[model samples]
Target: MTAPSRPPSDVSAGVGLAGLVGLFAWLAVCRAWPAIAFHLGLATPLEPLSGPTAALAAVLFSGLAMALWSVLVDKVHRRPSTGIDWTRPRPLDEVIDISITKIAGLWATWAVIGFAYCVARWYWQGQYVFAMEVLGAAMLPLFVLSVPYVLWLDRVLVDPRDGAWHFGAMLIGREACDPEQVRIHWRAWAVKGFFCAFMISILPPGWAELTRLDWAEVFASPFAMTHWLTELLFLVDVQIAMVGYLLTCKPLDAQIRSANPHLAGWVAALVCYPPFILMGPGSPLDYHYGTADWSVWLAGWPAPLLWLWGGVLVALTAVYAWATVAFGLRFSNLTWRGTLTNGPYRWTRHPAYLSKNLFWWLSTLPFLVTTHNVNDAVRNTAIMALVSAVYFWRAKTEEAHLLAEDPKYREYHAWMEQAPTLTRALGRLLGAARRRPALQPAE
Candidate 1:
């Protein structure tokens, strides 16, 4: 006979303890790398947050995160149910393994850079080994932590009796979570909740800015109206994207259809966020918004043409808004609900991504900015390109997973892949609409 299954408590404790070890291992190395290098004569001691202070901080931080997460798991596990169905199998280990694997790819990419730096520095007596050492130090910790972090996630998310993830469901005040209906992960909830809180937190200042905007001045300078318009549009879209899913979906428990599983795809998706997205070599994600070169190029044209540019921005923002409307109360990062065939989706596979990226390209405002160092500009350009590429990867990964699981996606994939773009998709839709003929005056 097969060995008996491990007890739930045992499994939970095992994963938690294992993750703690992984966290300790990585944090210890990150804290120790500089001193280790200095002792080995590979580089000088790092002055900023180095040595013992770094060690203490890393230990404290890791300990706190683990301790807090453990407490959260216990609380969540023991919390009373919210009455939704919880009969699905939760392949939590798979989620942990896949997510961690994807994150590791990020570590690998940096590891290469670290090694390249080491190789380059060897010629200069390894003096500037900071790049190599810092990244190199981070790799192992990140990789190791990924395992236990996932395990910890499993402990926190998966319920053996129900075999479903309820962290997200519980937060929405639901006693039970139905994966088939609405799935919420702890990570997504935290992010969505934080942003919603941020928007609410900034409301005072936002209102103050609105109050300060003079409509008279705005009418005299049509451009001035953009201040509030931008704010309004941003506020609406964010509120919907972040909070609507939790509040407005059918079932009253917004179910995230599915999340992406590919390692590279997920990392590419996540680095679009803070901290990691901000991780650049002396180049943070700090930039003011402005019009793109092409938009400025419109200035030499007629006044109508300039007005046309503003309309285009509005249209792009509308496309973004349309997507949220499509998602309604079911939106979450990196998850696929049913394929969208209506509204902007029929127009393009990834309307939001396309529109947002297009908006950014137009708003780069190249004409307004002076020429900068080629290297700096190129690096910035690469970062933007990487962001675009990540979204594209997300679209493909979503298609990959959905097509694998659903015949609906496969059919939709054939249709979307045939078009591969908005123009083509629109053309196809129009042709189909023409063939079907318009409804006669609603009878």
Candidate 2:
């Protein structure tokens, strides 16, 4: 009789097998099918390379159409107030609702349009291709269209009365509101929308390639050069995914949001937001709206993946843990338990916030789909660094607000007098140095 399998052993075996099957399936659907059909369709008369190529062709065309539509919408309909109108009484509630509706409508409308566009494009291409051709024709349009819709949605919606995310005065007189809470910025909405749309547009080719059989060759030659140049961008793709995960997954996100109730919205909004959507085996709406893509981990592991996987997870966790612990220490050691702490607390009462921003930057590492291209590496690194810097500024704003909020915080302000400018200088120097590795000695 065969020996009974231990739980851990069985789990490992199951996971590994699942990963292998997923990886191969993804490669076959994304890369192999497309290439084979493209070549075969080329050889067959009246077969217009119908599937993957046609789908790609549709995405390109539909993307252009969507971009144009955005510009046209900007010119024609032009929803006023930048989506989040702070001037409205109890604006937070109103803005939240409108934002939600806008996001949803934009996503749904564009998804449908995108799908239609791809099918039309494929039909026009008039080619015989593999099953992927039909699938791609059906899917690419939805994916492509989500970009612009997301942008427009952010521009049009603001404040719901009931504190739920909703649209304009359409649902007014339904809920009461307090004047005490702060409203979110409208510009932030536009910026976020643009970011989401841009992210959506950039993802398809690489992803579609990865989903097919000839995936390994995606970065093999001419594509390899492109991959290298945009490796950092590919990495940005990864960062986007990880950010989405951290925001959506309760175990990962709850810790951060536990600090403040308002942060719950931020965390939820960020996680499920449209920007991280990459085409694969899922609903485009799920992709465009907010949700986690478990399919990403379907493959067991990339060779040498342990370092990247473990390092990113560990670093992010450490950052958050340190923040929580530091906050605890600050509270426990303070002379007055309820009184505001001094030192780091004075200059920036929330070192945790600063650290949290840094964690976001670090956590993006494993998520970025790195390709073997110098350019890709540089681009992605630069983008993540830029985003990190932006977050740093955002953290500083939070610090400013915190300083203003607590009177006891004033006493700690004196520490800034003794604070070293060298730290910031050293940080920049170290960052630059680390970005470029030491030259390995010749063998």
Candidate 3:
């Protein structure tokens, strides 16, 4: 008989929670460094880390801390899921050619991404400027480091002929390569290329706001406090997520297993992000045309009500951030790095999407427009509904991808279907609606 199935999650609660603790600890230190320097009687007191460099450093710190926790405490490197066999490393002569091929594939991938960045006008404009500058600076180091890194990693990889190897083989017309592996290689790189820039671009603004804020002023108003806290949570989410994108090492068991192969999945995810976002101002799904925020709509309301509304919004934002934290170092869009079934994930399959949509609706109050035109109100509310529908589509696509890729995810999906959660409830409702026979035409 088959043995009883273990817990459905690949990631444990302690693993992610430990990483969260490490992240917050480092953030606290970064925030306190200037004061610490002043107390030590330095000639030039260290300034608050409010620059883009400092924000990038925060990503490094967060990534390092999470890596330590995963390796030392969780010992994820020993897991079979990593597809690494540290016990039996191959001889250098055996894997050198394979490593060389992989490195060639990797370098060519970076060159293509760099070329795309140069050609894309959006990368040079607005918030993307910082991303381009950071990537440009690191390009040399990344290229130099890949030789040794690939050479070392290939020795222990269970099968070194991964997607990158396949792509390399195809490029040089060497051994036969699977076309599907080449496709997966491009898909994974495309995800990393698009998102890493976007994440880096937005980091500085939030870091600057957080580091420069005066506590006195921030605490003076409910709205101000809520807004500041919300930004802080979002900053945490971005920093952790950037780490996930950068640290796809097998030793940490954070390497992506597969990117979503479905075109619908890519379309669903890309439309929600830069260069293709439909919900931005003046875009097709723009929902903020005439709607004022909660603060504006509820201005002059009772202080208690203001506090309550602000608190709820902040709580929702916190849940969204927590969903990212739950992934620890495995967070990314359109990739199955691993299964996460703890933290906010225990409550719903898509806590981030659910909380995010709710936050937008509650915060924007699209039904109450500043224009005082019934038409404006109706239009804004309808647009907001469409935005939520887009997220729903994104959720479905992600579920399909994950369900197909990993047995662990399938188990988690089954467990969640039985568990008393909003996802399960919705799943049942959808199942019932589908099962119900269409109304018979008059006989």
The lDDT values for all models are 0.48, 0.35, 0.88
Work out the TM-score per prediction: 0.48, 0.28, 0.93
Ranking by lDDT: 3, 1, 2
**lDDT preference between candidates 1 and 2, better one:** 1
Error of 2 at 312 (Å): 16
Give one digit per residue, the lDDT tens place, for model 1 in 325-370.
Answer: 5553345665554455656666676788889887776656422444
Candidate 3 off by > 4 Å:
1-6, 40-46, 425-443
Steric clashes per prediction: 12, 47, 0
Query: Which regions in candidate 2 have their CA more than 4 angstroms from the true location?
Result: 1-28, 34-162, 165-171, 178-182, 185-192, 208-443
Q: Could you list the CA RMSD of all candidates, in the order they appear?
A: 18.2, 19.7, 4.1
How does model 3 fare in lDDT? 0.88
Off by over 4 Å in 1: 1-212, 248-250, 278-302, 366-369, 372-383, 418-443
Instruction: Give the Cα-based TM-score of candidate 3 against the true structure.
Output: 0.93
Best by lDDT: 3
Deviation in Å, model 2, residue 123 alpha carbon: 25
Best-first order by TM-score: 3, 1, 2
Residues 139-233, candidate 3: write the lDDT tens digits.
99999999999999899999999999998998888889999999999999999999999999988998887887778867988999889889989
- By how many angstroms RMSD does model 2 differ from the true structure? 19.7
